[model samples]
Target: MISGDVDAELRRLADDPSFPHRDAARHAIRFRAEGDVSDLVAIEDDPHPCAMTDVVFAMAGSKRTWLNWVPMPAEAICNVANEVGSRRAEGEDLGLVSLALSAAEPASAITASERVMGRVELGIGDFPAPDIRMPLRRGRYAIWRYDGTDPVPAVPAPSGAAIRVLHEVGGEPWSSPLSGYVQAEPLGALPLADLLGLLAHLPGPPDTPRWEYLAKSTPTYWYRLLQPWVCLGILRHAADEPWATSTRREVLLDLALGIEDWTADAALFALVTAAYRESELRAEVHQVVRARLNAAASAPRLVTIEESLAHLMLITPGCTADDRALATAVLARAAEAGEEDEDEQAPPPSKAEKRRWWQRRG
Candidate 1:
């Protein structure tokens, strides 16, 4: 049997008016100890989106810290779409995990997303598997989603095939010197500017399935190819150049502002790189990046800003002293904000004491 204190806490949470799906939370807690998630499927029948989300999180034993949760039911999947739509409408940053999980549910999730987000701009990893039948609407575009994961398959590409595809896509051929460098050092060690140069010719949006296939099959080349365009947009803005006039620049900016659109590592890299290149932009970059980090930290589930900063340091060891200091300050502020939020959400000490009594009895 579950501990009486846990049961009472679950009941209290279920009854909490702030969360719409009270009964779902209660019942979900009741059955959470069960090994199989199938029993929780009935919660999907509930019309309240929050209730379904609660049940899904409960079944998966996932704390609702971040906006995203896993083991989401197919029926509850639409809730994620609805949330994404609403957040995008309000001009808020959606969490990275939320977008990835939503993409995993391609059908209704995609439909709801397109209806709300309009002409969805997807990353390479964001593409639904080739088998997925996307709607016939015209506005969706495919760009690279750089998560820092080496998507390159173990098998080497057929001779000349990679170069042929690069030429076909209008991208510059990989340089022999850079190729030798990549072979010698870690792929992450490649210069950001060179990566941007390679991405210059790659066309944006309206990409074909063939292009997607080629990119996915040869992820390292695809990453090197696509990053230039994404990185250049940030660099342009950092240099105080006029970027608002360009539609491509607008898309790239939108992707940056919409935190869920790109991987956390990719987003951080762009911001940090921009800051590193243009000392003048460090303050602005710090503010923007801090806001997103704080937003993630403030979510119901705790996403440590420190972890993100640590990952950034590991991937981009060349970050300047100023960059490191700014990141450190941003993380400290985010941590403080998270603590304040937790204090606000926590029940009174008297209530906690009573709950402790129940725990002692159990």
Candidate 2:
């Protein structure tokens, strides 16, 4: 039978008495929609979310949406920039990674981003050194959260603090331990599940998937990753386990951020980014930067990092306000040390040389 016959049969089975028939029909429509996402996208403006969700799963789970969305629109619009009719207006979730990355406008768009988001924006730059970096450092998305019943005492204001405390809560029983670090003012604690529930609906890939996209640039990179399967003769395992677990993937990303190597370290630093709240792995992070800078070829970059490292270190959580103040002092001392070196290197003016030079100037 032709495609029309199959389509008709599927519609009939959608409400069929057979248990397997209805389920089969459901999967069939999804697979078919995934292959022709434009058909679904055309109706995205429809208010029927139940009908829309099926399309979302198909597009996210299959190649049809990701592989074909661009060409379909370009042919219709002549230029996607000049025309506004495409799915760009729909705001319907398609779960396409490239769409999200491109929607964020990746590079030039990030300069306008304010803190937390700002640091992450820097990570997308072409190359790091010699590029003018912004002075407005990013902030963490995670605000300081605390639990306690009694009111907590105020902590001293941060002198040269890196982490900008956006909001805070205290006065519950658990406030004592949390109060010392943050320059925390008081508020009521948000319910734990409510807080996480709010976060779960936010767009953007979980950390690992985003990193994987960045680390491997294109289809060729993905194919190369598959070479291990070809060599191992374990095609079944490779097919079954493509993505890393959430925990492992997040750790890899933190490791990537903490360490200064990898091909695009400069690029990563250029993006405005927000990590999980109160997260800092600075010692491990700086060590990676230090090691990279010490490499024979990267001397100038090292010098630049040495100049900037203290400031960057404080911005991550786990660093104290005292640590931040100390870093500021150390930078000042480094400047003084340079002046002393200049004085020490200069030759003492001999009496005869000083007189001759003065006379010539007059």
RMSD of each: 23.4, 26.9
lDDT of 1 by residue, 1-362 (tens): 11235455666767789967766665567545542222233343346655345434333233311111111212222343445545654558754232323223223223333333343333223332321222112122223222332121212222233233323432432221112112222222223333233332222322455444433222122332333323433333333335335433343444344423222333444554444333454555555555554444343432222345333442232344554555556556655754764676555543212211111010
Q: Tell me the TM-score of model 2.
A: 0.20
Runs with alpha carbons beyond 4 Å of true place in candidate 2: 1-272, 276-304, 341-362
Best by TM-score: 1
TM-score of each: 0.28, 0.20
For candidate 2, the per-residue lDDT at 35 reads: 30
lDDT of 2 at 353: 23
- How well is each residue in 1-362 modelled by candidate 2, as lDDT tens digits? 02235455556766677633354355546546543322333222223434334333233222221111111111101122112112332333322211111111111112111111212211121233422121112222211111221111122222211111111111111111111112122111222222222211111212344324422222112211111111111111122333243222232233223322111122112110111111243344344333332331332322223333443333322334454555556467546755664666456643222211211010
Q: Which sections of candidate 1 miss by over 4 Å?
A: 1-229, 232-252, 263-265, 302-306, 313-362
Model 1 TM-score relative to the real fold? 0.28
On a 0 to 100 scale, what is the lDDT of residue 198 in model 1?
A: 30
